[model samples]
Target: MIEEIPSEPVVITHIIHETPSIRTFEFSRRFEAQAGQFCMVWVPGVDEIPMAFSAGNAITVQKVGEATGALFSLTEGDVIGIKGPLGNGFSPEGRVLAVAGGVGAAPLRPLVTYGQADTFILGARTAEELLYAGELAGKAEDLRIATDDGTRGHHGFVTALLEEADPASYDTICVCGPEMMMKAVLGILDAHGVADRGQFSLHRYMKCGVGICGSCCFDSSGLRVCRDGPVFTGDVLLRSSEFGRYSRDAAGRRIPF
Candidate 1:
């Protein structure tokens, strides 16, 4: 039976080591999750963090810092608390272009899987970090990769890949990646003569998964990312000078990228 994610720990029935630094934790059963929404994961004794579901039963994680390191160390049958499908989600329409950087593919994978066939430009530091390429390929009409190390496909940023794409071919672009990368994406879109009709995910410091905490708001407009969106259109992004410029930290202090 489908289960509701709860505050209490739930068993991780299986695990898939996607790459050296990335792993997928599979829960006992499927839980509802929209393509762009996230789950608040509590790693007992370590810390709580937000994760995006790659599939109903699985959430992919990149072992970056302390909390993620503890998350990746989890073995089969280990229980961890999870609560979500929270936040606004992406909705695909017409023709779509999806770009993902490293583990950012975790969320976009579901979008391509459930939506109409689309194209993708997935980038990472190296070939090994280019996540879900094989899985995403099956769902994508065109699959391209940009690696910083030139170990795989194009030897440049994903924005370079975006630059080469005929912007007119697709109705819109959707991106999720580093703040700097998304900022570069905006510049590329402007140069390509594409209207700011695209959409992208904005990652901010989120404490409460709900809107109670004011941590994830735009600097000026006060639009809440956790509630109003984690995904916003290019038009919305254009209005906020803070879109790719800076993000608030745990204490709500602006940190420039």
Candidate 2:
């Protein structure tokens, strides 16, 4: 029989800086976790935040707040509470294309490890802010990088790169990035008649990683992002006005669009 997994604190055994602002945390787990899923990271007396798994074996976290800042300060053997590898993750079944922007590339790293014919498009404002270049370069069949300031490979938005990409060559696409970038990508896919063929990871402030908090809701078919997603399809996001606009925190405070 499968042993019941307990919800408890796990010790952070390693931390690796990926970029100036992004870091990856390694946690000791008794079992393997699915790629693209996240865990509720509880920093004692501070706060708990939902962070997605970047590398499958290591729980990677981007330093975005006070709680996460504290997490980055940790060294090996430091402990933190963790509840899950909860929520849905991407199903990498066939030929795929992965698009990520800034720290958004963290979660897609694990997906790259599973053998597949995949291409990755990563975007950032500058070369210094980019993460996982070496990792992605080795895993993807084709790797493309874009920067907004013309400091990198392609001097344009990632959507511009998407526009130039041969979408018909891939069987599936996965996107994770700024809401506007994903929306732009969706538009590009739609124009190519491939909108229904891709998946997107929606980033939002989530508390109580479980559904009780009601903090991560979006208007797509009455979908609750915390429960139904942090990931959804282009088709679902397109129908929702709130997908790119409104978001809330644990206290139900409206986060500015």
After TM-score superposition, what is the CA distance of residue 27 in candidate 1 from its true location, in Å? 1.0
- Give stretches of model 1 more than 4 Å off: 1-8, 193-195
* Cα error, candidate 2, residue 251 (Å): 3.5
lDDT of model 1 at position 4: 42
Tell me how far candidate 2 lies from the true structure as C-alpha RMSD in angstroms.
Answer: 2.7
How many residue pairs collide in each prediction? 0, 0
Strongest candidate by TM-score: 1
Worst 10 residues of 1 by lDDT: 1-10
Q: Which digits, one per residue and each the tens of the lDDT, describe model 1 over residues 28-94?
A: 7677877888878899998878788778788999888889999878899899988877777777778
- Candidate 2 yields a Cα-based lDDT of 0.76
Which tens-of-lDDT digit does each residue in 1-257 have in candidate 2? 22333457777777788888887777776435566777777888788888777754466666777997888788889888777777787766667888889878877887777754378899998987877887778777789999999887899888877777877566778888888788788888878888777788887778667776566777646676666877787777777877667676767776766
Error of 2 at 147 (Å): 1.3
RMSD of each: 3.2, 2.7
